[model samples]
Target: METGKSYFFVGIGGSGMMPLAMILAGRGAMVAGSDRSLDAGRVPAKFEALEKRGIRLFPQDGSGISDAQQVVVASAAVEDSVPDMVRACEVGATRMSRPELLSRLFNDSVRRIGVAGTSGKSTVTGMIGWIFDRAGRDPTVMNGAVMTNFADSQAPFASALVGEGDAFISEVDESDGSIALYNPTIAVLNNVSHDHKSMEELRTLFGDFVGRADAAVINTGDPESAAIAAGLDREMVLTFAVDRDANLTARNLKPEPFAISFDLYIAGDFRQTVRLSVPGRHNVENALAALGAALASSIPPPRAVPALESFTGLRRRFERVGEANGVAVIDDFGHNPEKIAATINTLHEFPGRLLLLFQPHGYGPLKVMRRELVAIFAQKLKRGDMLVLPDPVYQGGTVTRDVTSADIVADLAPAGIDARHIPDRDAAAAHLVASAKPGDRIVVMGARDDTLSLLAKRMLDDLNR
Candidate 1:
């Protein structure tokens, strides 16, 4: 992240790429990029916001990579056949992967906090960032999702906050094995589950991730995370849990529709009652993880716990779009089994039938977790609940389609779950809206796609009609 260095991101509008581009631009680096979404005329607001920041946007053609000194940054998903990459090679521009550059900047920071896991990474990172900001630490924070606490009219996408403090907080990804690149002073491991990689591989990656950190904050309730904690020195680990005894624990959880209240305990001593604006026991676990990171960073409980009270959460994690005609629509980033289960469990706490539209994030993920996805939907959806599936999101990548959304729907049928495979997302939304009752909750769940939020809003709008 050298000052005044020119960087061009191939997939500039992506969740991971957008924040890094903003951070680079904020730090005096000349930033510009291009996206296929921009070419397709999708999500114009996101491209408009980027252009407003003086980051030039171009079509996905080779026109964006003219300068030889301009460094081209791309995610692992970007194929070498992309015109930008080909043009970069033609122009002899330096090429760097997104994680490579991000890790470089993360490793350079004096005090780095890396939040990792299969689930709750974004929420926990947002919580830690909000706490540090409220404490006046002026920390620079990077996250995959927009932090609603920092989002406003000027900066609608506040995924990255650039500050002058010594702390640099970011969520490190293990799905791509890039978690090894980060070296954190304080590391937070929420939980491990089957998402992108095998449990054995995830364990090895997570174990080494915390191994590099000076202090690790782990969730004892998760068996995989607890196993990792078992091998670490007790003095170097700060453990948190809701169902198990740990260094930090939450007791007497009171779940609400959109918020939750719980008693915070530290080492068996009662501390204070914590009321989080975000709902779900998963969030209660997330809160404990963030507080553990803050504690490991030497921030007092009085200062850190109170900031979570004001934390409004991320944009797509169970974000309520609107309520119309007694039916509520929620937009969620619940692509994996664990995240989907958490969302279902939290919503089921109240008395409402759930009409779910779960678009698989990718064809590859469907192939990887076909059985797990089917099992989660069958186990979580009650007899009266309805489920709809759109085709997995495909953005011009070559992938095997052996396991499609139809397979998932077929699998759910044996369990007496009412599920349908509506290949078109618009038709899926229509089904969700048409089937939604007065006391039902219409939930749009998926990841890797920004249009899901817009779909949720449209469902609410149709319900209003």
Candidate 2:
């Protein structure tokens, strides 16, 4: 909580942990951390970049907890038996959850805009951050994914930006119930769907998140988000919709394989024609949410539209890896049912056969959403589309493997889908490469596992050969 104090993150390279650690280091704090990936000698480049920026990196051993004066920061994923946690206990260092520390820093800002949802939080957060930055607000922004707009030679993984301005923007997480921690001046709820929690629990958490904001941006297009907004005072809410009437609305929509164009209407008045470089109708909804949040913060619609138009996209969301011999490879982070459905729907707008390699992020998610995931894939993927599955990526946890990718593949086969369970990712890649045709589009989809991106590249190389 104080400057010049030493802080060590337990899982520093995690999507949520990395940006918060970077923000602390940028604020002149003594930042250092350890990660399991570094311990296993995987993804050394990300940690090496942190080290070059003056943040100390160590293996997940007990060595990072050098003194009692340091504050040990960790996420909910870190258990008590971990070496860093044990060492922190022995050394008497003050321990804090990553959310707690992030909320502390976020609350200190003059104005805060927090984006909360079941999906598209990272993209919407990046959009708002880019809009504010382009408008010369110089806002301090935090995101779970790398913003392509901010990626450069020095900070290739530019997930967080430290700027001198009144606004602090971040994507708040409800999966861990950390969305309740921060009180924001402007809060944007993109959509509420089942991810890590139940519908009742998600509704309660998101409702509280919206109720706490001075001005809330509600997505009326999503029934759950609309329900949450209905309970709150209508005067304090700014609504955005694609289907019905709202304070800000998107009309005359067109969806392409890699791009979309739409017209913007503010309060039933024609504002301007907006175009997005990103695909999917969901991204159109995300743009509306970002626009509403910007308007709620008193930025005019005209000023924000240009930034949204120029917004390229995030790193893994519908990112094109490469193309060779009429075969193209795309890397995406769509593990949950809603996310996967969105990506598949976007792909249907184009005319290419899909060869999908999906890795479930965890065993618990597979168990919880197995039926919904199967139903989604059955409905979205046509007969020509093929699905390949490997075992879920395990990052050292005791989990119940009650349901697996094999079960989903079995379910899909009965539904007329071309699904296969290979178990081994390497074998799956080889099979996909061998089966790929000239017009096939290879899509690598998953989350939490950073190696999936590398696998996407490998598939592209094999296709080229």
- Cα miss at 188, model 2 (Å)? 0.2
Clashing pairs in 1: none
**Candidate with maximal TM-score:** 1
Give one digit per residue, the lDDT tens place, for model 1 in 83-165. 99999999999999999999999999999999999999999999999999999999999999999999999999899999999
TM-scores for all candidates: the values are 0.99, 0.98
RMSD of candidates 1 onward, in order: 0.8, 1.1
Writing each residue's lDDT as its tens digit, candidate 2 over 1-465 gives 357989999999999999998888888899999998889987787898789779998888899899999999997778999999999999999999999999988889989999999999999999999999989999999999999999999998899999889999999999889889999999999999998899999999999988988999999999999999999999999999996799988898898778999988888998788889999899999999999888888888779999999999998899999998889899999999999999999998878899999999999889888888999999999878999999998899677889998999998888999999999999998998898888888899999877788899988888888
lDDT of the candidates, in the order given: 0.94, 0.91
Off by over 4 Å in 2: none
Residue-pair clashes, model 1 = 0
